[model samples]
Target chain A: MYMSVAELVDAAKKTKKPIYELVIEQEMDTSHNTREEIWDAMGRNLDIMAAAVKKGAEGEGVFSKTGLTGGEAVKIKNYRSAKKTLSGDLMMQAVQNAVSTNEVNSSMGVICATPTAGSSGTLPGVIFTLKDRLDLTRDQMIQFLFTAGGFGMVLANNAGIAGATGGCQAEVGSASAMGAAAAVELAGGTPEQSAEALAMAISNLLGLVCDPVAGLVELPCVKRNAIGVGNALISADMALAGCTNKIPADEVVAAMDKVGKGLPSTLRETGLGGLAATPTGVRMKEKIFGKAVDAKA
Target chain B: MTVNYKSVFDIIGPIMIGPSSSHTAGACAIGRAANSIFQETPTDIVVHYYESFAQTHKGHGTDYAIISGILGFEPDDSRVPYAIGLARDQGINITFIEEPEDSPINHPNTAIIELTNSKDGKKVTVAGCSIGGGTIEIRGIKMNGFDIKPKGPLPILLVPGSEVDQQNVTDQLTALTKVNEKKQYQSAKGDLFEYDLDRRLKPEEVKELAKNNTNLVYL
Candidate 1:
């Protein structure tokens, strides 16, 4: 509805312009880069993310990857004395309850901040990767996290990362987008290149939701951050390789808001539309009732 | 030629360093704050540990966060691996030391910073904390045994030890009593302003007109 001829671009330039083709205007830009700077940024962010996840697995806060505390480990060890197949429910439960994400914004305190509760794993997951996978020094990782945070801070102000407002696209999508942008910057991509990566992330995750099973953060959310982090890295790689998105990060954020507003409440966090009323949920409810009746006996 | 959206990425794409955006992101703000506090690149730094930042410092990469701050590392610089070595190469000595078990405890994320630049005999002690979301509160800093309090609205942010340091260090602190301060941004509302006929603007804009504009004038 809004139209400015020159603001849109000249008719002659429009014919010559293509989304990816136009990004090469770096010469006229002031955001010059030294190749080494970009690599360090990516390495640093990955380190911090990995470290955060490792911390969560260490049993701080609610994340206890090792479900078998001292009280239960001894009993489980004795019962499985002949442990040949190495099967244990405690191990399974630990995996289930351990090292996941949140449904709303969770606090990392002194560390980097994650988005919605459901995708809390995104930032920390990347940090863990840097620490275990790469040879990044401790300090470099810290700098990288700061750079990545700078990217996220802009988005946190510009975009809404909740399903209730901007949908899963805003939550996981924004995180992925922010990750992609930081990765690009770390790799020496120009500001425009970083924004393109962010755009791709937001567009890819458009229409995502915050539906959790039984209203618990345990299901789907944790895995989503892992996926989102991977996706953002991929997008950053693509952006760095000269690929670009047509939409701006700001525009995509606006679109996310519109889509979220259009989504039905049932499709949001409401249990009615998603996994809440699934067969698993029904079975769990039935088990609860059966246990209550048996206890009366 | 017409500029497209992807064109921007051609200049500045995003970075990929860590998991959480704010924690990792806020670290940059901390670095920036520390950098501003210390005028020159720090040669040596000791980040005192707090219980909250102590246990999780490693996991959150808090150690790296503060180190870059000392080295005057920019938020976008991704070469964090080389960062430590670069800092060392630049004669910047950085280390993390936890408080003694017997010492009095304070905020968990609080840090006691000791920055030394013996080249010019500039030694400073800054105690502060990176309270989440990139917000930093510099409780205080000392040049020597004497505390050099900030006199103006903004605490003395100058990293001292030069001739200017001695002159700026006042024996007594003239604490701000009660005076109207200017707003960060200009508007008809948020901050106090004069609504006189001679609408005063910025120093460049309003000029001394602001001093007389009784409505907008703090006096």
Candidate 2:
């Protein structure tokens, strides 16, 4: 089985199979399960993600318990319908889908944690929004997830995908990278281009911290997911357009790990510093919980 | 080295209800494993939270998730939010111990639960950690006076920890079923015994096999 993005791309090119098929083979070797079983499970996850998207886009999204993130997706939807937006229909749809997924997650609705719950919105967001635009089939959508999962596995093995161990760079940043790589493959780009897409996406979001206000996965988390999808889409386009990444995907992941290690714990989901320590952030926490809280509490 | 991600599902999805997967869904899995390991509903449970969990568990619903798990609620269940009230209604006493930030356990999302059964007053302690992405690892378990590092899912039979014949246990287990692997671990607490077998044993089959050996306890 491949352990790095370089090896994954090499294997994909050598075997003359898509990256998703290679990933499926890896799963078969490890789990001893048939391909159909694995595909059915992934199909279920897609259905869940689609359901959450529909639920979120239907109304002024349900406000989170902390009242930090909600209704942004619906607002964007309305804006797209009523006015000429610079982002265009496809990009706006991607942004809205991403925000809606995170909004559903914040409201305690069921969601598939794509790499992580904190960054769950990116892959499905880009995939579902472009499904019609790309004229993709249901199998193609599942293949998209498999390709993303393959890239995410590479990052997780080389670096990590957790905000606690790494930073927001590892969570949302890795998700964006995974999405970009899958988008490249789905768009019929070469395996080399997919790896380059990964490198581009990650480099764009390097050193981002994970300072959720009040330690809740709302606030900047939801909006960051929207930005993450945008980053993934643009990076995918850049890779498909034949832009070469100076740094390789594997080295970029290692660099992200190093940057994550350099960040203080306060900037890594502890809520002890960064935006969580801001005056307005503290006031919002007190207003929600009816008392001031210590950063170390 | 720490992860065992075998499939696409391990990375892309767990399909759970969540505000935070590390805190909520992963915590629920640990608690659910604890519930199953104890083999009965606990009359009382004491949980200890450490590091990031100690500080932000309330906001992330980590506590709610674990309690709901003890109450046999799935990670995706809607009843998770009201688990505390449900526990009280069932006459289950729950206590939480939040460790100081500096005196925390190694992992940021870690918990140790002590559960006591009502009828026999038997107790078990399970130490687990949520290692992010709605995944968990149960590090150690102390039950029936034995320390077991069970590597597999429940319906396991744990033998009491004593300076007993490892060869004898292996022989007996092999006689009962095909033993895949036998391993011994030494921790600061004491020695732990573990076995990976070719097949999972039913509780009744475990009892039948252990009828002559009083030290074996079905877990």
Per DockQ, the best of the predicted structures is 2
- Write candidate 2's Cα lDDT for A138-178 as tens digits: 99999999999998888876787778768899889999999
Q: Report residue A158 deviation for candidate 1 (angstroms).
A: 3.0
Interface RMSD of 2: 3.1
Docking class of 1: incorrect
Taking the tens digit of each residue's C-alpha lDDT, what string does model 1 give over B19-39? Answer: 222223334434545555556
Q: Candidate 2: which pairs clash?
A: none
Q: Which stretches of candidate 2 lie over 4 Å from their true place?
A: A292-296, B102-105, B148-182, B185-192, B195-219
> Which lDDT tens digits does candidate 1 get at residues A1-297?
001212112321455542122222221121233334544544543444444443444333333121111122122234445454243433322222213333112222222234433455565544434434445566545544544444454454444444433445666776677667666655656666767787787788888875544333344445566568777767887888889787766677677778876876545543234554578743542343343422221
The local lDDT score (0 to 100) that residue A203 gets in candidate 2 is 97
Q: Return the TM-score for candidate 1, rounded to 2 decimals.
A: 0.41
Q: Which 10-residue window of candidate 1 chain A scores lowest in summed lDDT?
A: A1-10
Taking all chains together, each candidate's TM-score versus the true structure is: 0.41, 0.88
Query: Residue B109 of candidate 1: its Cα lDDT?
Result: 46
